[model samples]
Target: MSMTSDIYKTIAKKSPESLFKDRGSKFIGQAHPVKEEAEIERILTELKNKHSKASHICYAWQLGKNYEHYRANDDGEPNNSAGLPIYGQLQSFEVTQILVTVIRYYGGTNLGVGGLIQAYKTAAQLALESANIKTKVITEALQIDFEYALLHTVMRIIKEEQISVTSQKMELSCSITLAIRKKDLNSIKKRFDAVFGLTVITENF
Candidate 1:
């Protein structure tokens, strides 16, 4: 079956040095979920605030199939050189919901149109390397409740396995909500059955 949404993360960043010494560049890449519009604006604000003194701040963001729906400001650099290069890099990597901004502090010398393009591209490449990428997998939600004594055992297994517990309560009994893949159900069931010597309850996510 085709899932409506798939989670993804940045794995590695790519930035290479340029012989164009007259130009200096900086790259900042961050992963974001497309759940809300405010999230994008907030990140952009943070970038601007961080590099308030830079000569120019050029950026691009990908949110959905309509990628061209984004805007980039060359700030003051020659026309398309600054922002487009950064956007090109994102397209090459097939990334989305990511905003990359390149801050440039002009060296006394000027990098004409070609040089400016290389400089901005180089900056975005550097930021790309700093991110870690990951792919999300679908899993079911399982809830478990056990006495304090047995809670430790359950937690231990959870920590050691691929399952991730999303919530929990620890008063007389520890009630936990965990996320697990369907394929691993039998194995987890066996382990729990052996440890607690009983069955547990589960709920759909």
Candidate 2:
């Protein structure tokens, strides 16, 4: 699909980590896919707890297909030395919905501001490169309910449109949750709306 056609780039299924050392300081960087700010906080908390003795924990993250939200934190490093460089690496890779955290262990030597920037940048780059990166379609979840008689029609539209059914419940009345690519969602919704007995119960982005 074209770049503008309902698609986004994100890390594959797994997170990756890397380590870098400059002078005597050790930098450990890890990359993880975060679908929400809550996940970001949780991951950061976990990392901080895991490396509680580290000198600093710095991070950068971008969210949304359009990169609607992003932040970088130096974590006591000299100004932009730790975070901005890490964020720049993410931009270079063109990946969103990801967070990268770098933990430092002060190895009894201070790698000046420039040295810190390079070390963090290189560490984040290594983590990202070691990760499995992939592109995915931007999708929205939709919950649909319909009478049993309209099941055939609904299923046919879903098949023709290639919508992924995330969950379903079949009974006297039926319900199905679908993951529909953003570009195809409106068209598919219109199709289901035309069927009198079909009802769209909830839509989640």
Q: Which 10 successive residues of model 1 have the least lDDT summed?
A: 11-20
* Global lDDT of each candidate: 0.63, 0.87
lDDT of 2 by residue, 90-152 (tens): 988888889988899999988888899899999999988888888877788888898888888
RMSD (CA, Å), candidate 2 to true, equals 3.1
TM-score for candidate 2, please give it: 0.80
What are the clash counts of all predictions, listed in order?
A: 10, 0
- Top lDDT prediction, candidate number: 2
Candidate 1 lDDT by residue in tens digits, 27-110: 333333343457667866876788687677677666543233455668778888888888787766666556666766555666
- Candidate 1 at residue 78, lDDT? 88
How far is each candidate from the true structure, as Cα RMSD in Å?
7.4, 3.1
